[model samples]
Target: MMDQPATSRTIDTQCVVAGSGPGGLMLGLLLARAGVDVTVVEKHADFLRDFRGDTVHPSTLDIIDQLGLLEELLKVPHTQAPRLHAEIGGRDVTIADFSRLPTKCRFIAFMPQWDFLDFLAREARKLPNFHIVMSAEVTDLIEDGGRIAGLVARTPDGSVEIRAPLVVGADGRNSVVRAKAGLEVESFGAPSDVLWMKLSHQPDDPPYTMGHGGPRQGFVMVDRGDYWQCGYVVRKGSFAEVKEKGIEAFREAVAAVSPLPADRVGEIRSWDEVHLLSIRIDRLKSWWRPGLLCIGDAAHAMSPIGGFGVNLAIQDAVAAANILSVPLREDRLADRYLAAVEKRRAFPTKATQKLQLMMQSSSKKRQESATKRSGPPSFVRGIARWPFLAHLTGRLVGLGIRSEKVNMAALKAR
Candidate 1:
């Protein structure tokens, strides 16, 4: 809703963020903190519904701590996912141990995505510069002279046109802003589909475990407190077939792979509790236009293997905010904002895509070999066994792997 009288002022110096998910809302919060007039438009009216992608990784925990949100986040009902145990070659190996991480808060927090988003939204509302327009859908981007300047939205009452100096596309994989900007996304690898369902917490539930079946390549992350998020490997477009087989068959498949008891699986009944996500890694050659920039799932969509979507989205928000803080205060800041955002996000996007490919490899032999390993792979285990190797491996996989260096470099550059 418009805060001021329509006759008194025009909608100038606006920031149109298309999605009000974690990425968009976080961006809104950061921009609003920087004294930017931000308007976040979300299609959803409330944040009570269930959604996929719940695991908050350790890297994001560090950022949350830096933002002074770590304590508040811990106050929420969440399970500390300390260990990432995977069944490789029928042998369990702990790949990521949060307790060993350097950060004070080391564990990956297992909380519903909606809860996290709701927390962020509550914090963002405390800032006067932030305005959230829920139940409003962005129909299209308003372009002026080959540059993105604003967006046209269909609100509850009527059409609202918000003209801004910069438009950030934080919408999910299917981004309206990306389409309007005519950005070309370079498709990297094959699509990996996941059929995910959650089960109710039972008294007899097994100990917290993370399971990965070799042949099926399915994974299950059991929360420490209650509920289990189960994901199955399926064909790229076979969600309907899996659903057609009925919930009983699905439960059997999950029980056979996961460490949890079969009876616990019976708690799931409705299709509403289950969701199918088609995952892919897409990188745009350019993440900027004349007056707009894309971040999070809008610019790069990585495979969901490492549970990195939400973390990467938040990281992207940090980068974009840091880059735009200075430029956004100027009269013509769109160009510099876009360039800086792209520079900050480029390496991270590429590194994440590479990791996605490593996880998505469908080679049965590789899966079997990985599953057969007694502990973390020889290369990884060798390091864990020795203090030096452990530190080295930790540095390589935990921090040095992928885009951490690049992200840190970007932050330093800013």
Candidate 2:
């Protein structure tokens, strides 16, 4: 156990951030850079796995560049998934073209989330004020007079009581800290379950591409060189059923919808290679309670649509860091920090959720229509023939759908 520094001890202000994922690590790094003694705790001991949410959006890349970690991140093996090719309203459109964006870091980079988390951890370690404890799980939060005071965590050796003025919950969707704080979250829509798997790629495999079959239907993103991230849509909680169907049936399903070559899909076998990601979004009415605040998935979990979960989590981390970088003793600093984070992220969260619902509903409709009709829908044919309507419909469903100006307005209102 490390003793509190003199500076931190003088004010009795210690910040404990739970979960050493990207959001928690970045939050710890930012706070430490601002001269705040921060400790980041994680349940996992190492970043070694294939997880979902690998695509880093351009907006998040901008923030990474702002933090001076862009150069280091680029050095890591990553695939630039710049074009979002989506089959919306039965017409294919590409949004988020790297050429159109003004920033030098305009492309969406596709790398494992673990790699991104590792990069953040490495950068955070450079700051002496930042400390990280792996293999330590936060089991309970310590409350003082209805405000968060610290946390009770179980390390490998034993349980330890760590004190802090502000406790941050960056611990993901199933956060123990949020539960301990007694925060109520409002969930939306039925759960969207995904059967995610990675296939080995030969050197001669075709170049990486993103292919979206329809709404509700899962898509594929080529990561690094030969490995392709593929997802299949299933009911809210039907992973076991899908798994029972076997890998061969799953490959046939992928071949039916995706643009990927049949040979690649054939390589996948066993449930071990396939990951099941059950997606749900919840928004807490209030992300702050006295001395505690929640960020990242702990604060709001959004749909995987647009791969905005990680980006949004990092965005919340950045916003929280900006607001809390000031002295905690400052009057209502915690209150202002919560308000700022909620304000900055609410619109983005809403926008992404709306998109997710739209895609889910549309995909269901398309599947139903496919079952009823022998051929493509008339509306799809109309759009395909009329290029003008195709572009217009694309803009409506795919391009510039979220207004940054409106989102910024919501942030300013807070």
Candidate 3:
């Protein structure tokens, strides 16, 4: 009988990316497009989870445009927010105007994160070398001679060990890959957490996507076609207290901060409908080890103030892929190369975190003075009145401090 080719049970690739979030998925897609065999391991069965980062900033859309996927991706359901408004005290102030941004897509695209991930996955699969292993969770590092050779992941069949020269940890803030690699993070505790709830959309609600804050209560409402996705900002570690107070009290508090129709606030009738995200402003002091690299929230956790998390993650992926793709493909990547990724991204990460901390402090002060009744503060009016300040604020919220560009040459198929 002719010798039969043995069925290979082990999955091998040039790179094993942990977490299928924006950063991980982008890096995987970019690397695969460059003809590198890459595999992404996702802990979840699918990207259908709720309350993920849904704001796709202009910078990220530019990346999609660069890759020629923007038009197709936009076909998915989404809304464009060209301006950000905040009803402070009782005055309506424009906080950010994306119309002033230079990018082709000047507005923030609000789409469910799952749709974004699905778009990337679908695009990546068009390339023959890309692979995604869903429902596979990374459990430990596969060490060989004191280097992070690869990782051990628990999958459906059993424990599966993947060995590769490079293991990218895009897992997230609480990252198993980062933990296994022993990366230390410096946390600047957040003053507030967010309670995510939705209210039914009404025709009478203000047309502008806006934030509303009155004394201690702050919430943001974004138009999602038929509904209002509301974020109720509360003091850090207050979920238990909020819950103990019962759903009606929480509903009234949120209702007070919403710019939407107050009657619709009753839509949030149960605590079950609300999701709590304990905000933390943190970053890894160092973003890499000998054979492992962390990006996105795995390297730096952003506060939800500006909806910058998804954009930052996408930028990190671009920078990392630009720096590491060639070295990884040629089988000559080194720790210094990983160091360069950190060096390139550290400034923006620090700058964003610093701003988030400032916002948190300011919010805490506002909450303490909740009893005061007044009009919008001078700064709020100044931001709306001064064109320069408004433009600067818009750029900061839209493009970030230093936006990253994905090198087309690096991503070109070989």
Which candidate number would show the highest TM-score if scored against the true structure? Answer: 3
Clashing pairs in 3: none
Residue 167 CA error for candidate 2 (Å)? 0.6
Put down candidate 1 lDDT per residue, 239-322, tens digits, no spaces. Answer: 888789987887777777766666877777767777877877787889888988888888888666556677778778877877
Ordered by TM-score, highest first, the candidates read 3, 1, 2
Question: How does candidate 3 score on lDDT?
Answer: 0.83
Q: In candidate 2, residue 311 scores what lDDT?
A: 70
Q: Residue 136 CA error for candidate 2 (Å)?
A: 0.8
> Judged by lDDT, which candidate is best?
3
On TM-score, the stronger of 1 and 3 is 3
Candidate 2: residue 150 Cα off by (Å): 0.8
lDDT of 3 by residue, 1-414 (tens): 001111224666789999999999999999987778888888888899888888889999999999999999999999888878888666677788888788998888889889999999989978888888887889999888888988888876677777889999999989999888888989899888889887787787787776767666577777788988888877789899999999888878877777665677788868889999989988998999888999999999998767778878999999989998889888898999999999999999999888777767766766667677433334555776774686677798889989988888877746
Give the lowest summed-lDDT range of ten residues in model 2.
403-412
Which residue pairs show collisions in model 2?
Answer: none
Q: All candidates' TM-scores?
A: 0.85, 0.83, 0.94
Candidate 1, poorest ten consecutive residues by summed lDDT: 405-414
